[model samples]
Target: MTVALSLGATANLGHAQNTLNVATWGGAYGQSQEAAIFEPFAKETGVSIDTVTYDGRLAKLKTMLNDDGTVVDVIDVSADALNTLCKQGLLETIDASALGAGPDGSAAKEDFLPGALSPCGVASVAWSTAIAFDRKAFPKGAPTAISALLDTAGFPGIRALPNNARYSLELALLADGVPPENVYRELATPEGADRAFAALDKITGAVRLWNKAQQAITWLVEDDVVMAASYSGRLFRAAAGDRNIDILWDGQIYDFDAWAIPKSSDNKKDALRFIRFATVPARLADQAELTAYGPMRKSAFPLVGKHPVINVEMLEFLSTAPQNFQKALKFDAAWWRGNGAALQKRFAAWRARVNAARTDREAARKAKEAAEKEADKAAP
Candidate 1:
């Protein structure tokens, strides 16, 4: 089932003999990988890592892996994508023994968080999608919970939500008073999907939908929105430069990203070596220092300290920090893996209805204005 890579494609022309091709989502995340993972791994093992950027498209990964000559050795994938790929037999099942030991000589399974060690991948970092608000817009009282994000009367202003249904439905259910623990359980049923969409219906007109993580941050920065559902890391970076932007950790949806190798990759050995080297507690902590994401390994928390460049402490901004972690909702990737398609279809239908309603409203307003102008001309 393995696809062979052409030697020319993988051979480091002017670099080290061994090369590992890694795929990641670009931007700050990519920079962090270069500084915290790739460079250090190359220095240690002489494996020159070639980084590529993608939009986390599973189809692209599948196509590359299924082709006769594939170049992607390792990829950074979201938990749900990892689950889907693993189910489809697209990714390699990593050996826990191949993963290096923790500082105290604990096994990889024992070292990583409860759900971190999957058959296809190991969790890299813990991140969250939380509510971020502009301080100047909400000078006195800001949103304190997920409920407030949906409550137009309580917190009146334009709100931004991700165009996708992933976190959107979960946040709606939470706002409707579904307990964090029961969110995924309830979402499994038809009634639960109805309730989530019903909650979303209330704020459809007031919400500005954003497709990109940076777009959400931009809306908050330009005052295009009073508040937005944002990736915690994006908001942290924005807040670092602009104090006016702040994140509300309450009801944040916490999830992890993992490093997975394509089943057909030719450089599985080098990829495994890099994964083992990069995921060790100290290296994981290094990643956290470079970005706002929390380290995946429990042991890494003890090692995480101040930001490497910024003078601020990293713990307070991390999703796994005690105060922030307490009220957060740990995303259920299993539920998404099982019910995602059906729910996505329902969400699409609901969105179409909302768009139609908006169009109707605009049409009515325009017709009324036209009639008013015509009547005034006749009177004159």
Candidate 2:
């Protein structure tokens, strides 16, 4: 008997067995990963898979959960979004036991990173948020630590910071000499956020906030800004494009993108099957190669040296060196899920204040230039 699905479900419950839909963040990376791995799986399993873009995924998932018969099945999101979905009961718990099959018909769990094979989601890719500087612009070595980026007195140049409060604030605190391990605990209080903001205030005059990834990449490439805290993937692209950019692996923040099955799906088994195939080491490696993202599977590390996406030599300079990997502050997705909204409000207010100050400075400078020009004309 065919498995009974919720009425009006999007799952093809007919002769077409493996057809499914996947929701992912849109970009060249998404398209490449889909074509390389997900599309191939569709052909192998006789499934016709469709891919759609869902940016700002957490808010989208919440809307889908509230409405029944939502079409989304498999979703690719940041670790923070995954945790938020899991906590909101928007994602189905996955059973990895069913996915293991090998030469000896054993589970593939051993091939992946420990704690990564979660019941609700699995970290599919690893990438770093690091300090990237244009070598020609700075000429000196890239800023080594977060503190170095924060040090305007020594390193005087315009810098880019993400508009997001959580990670940005964490970096600010880290630059202020807050021990990495103590960052999260300290960020829990208003006083802590104040300190982070105050530290950031020192560089406020020198900062340009980048809200979108593409904008950040363009900024780095055009030398619009000398140095920006950006994703490792973007840095790879910049380096590959012959831009004289170097990444400071010291104090780099690492984050993961995870695959999750939404709880509102009509076909849990099919979703799990797709996720399993997607997470397979070979497939994961291919996706990483196509997307320039690092693979989460431990077995995929060796493949890293071969991929054009990674800077193999730069890997030696990683802040995530085995000893320091644990030292980097892991994003607290749970806190983000609970307090993200409020924090965003606070961040917006702060940003507005910064913008106003910048506007005033620019207006004053323009006024002074106009006055100087008028005086020169009158004297002549």
Clash count list over all predictions: 0, 0
The per-residue C-alpha lDDT of model 2 at residue 64 equals: 60
Model 2 residue runs over 4 Å out of place are 1-16, 62-73, 88-90, 99-111, 263-267, 305-327, 337-380
RMSD of model 2 against the true structure: 6.2
Clashing pairs in 1: none
User: Which residue pairs of candidate 2 clash?
Assistant: none
Which candidate has the top score in TM-score?
1
Worst 10 residues of 2 by lDDT: 1-10
The whole-model lDDT of each prediction reads 0.82, 0.70
Candidate 2 per-residue lDDT, tens place, 53-154, comes to 777556776776567455777788888777767877778887677664433445667656655677689778777777777778655555666687788877
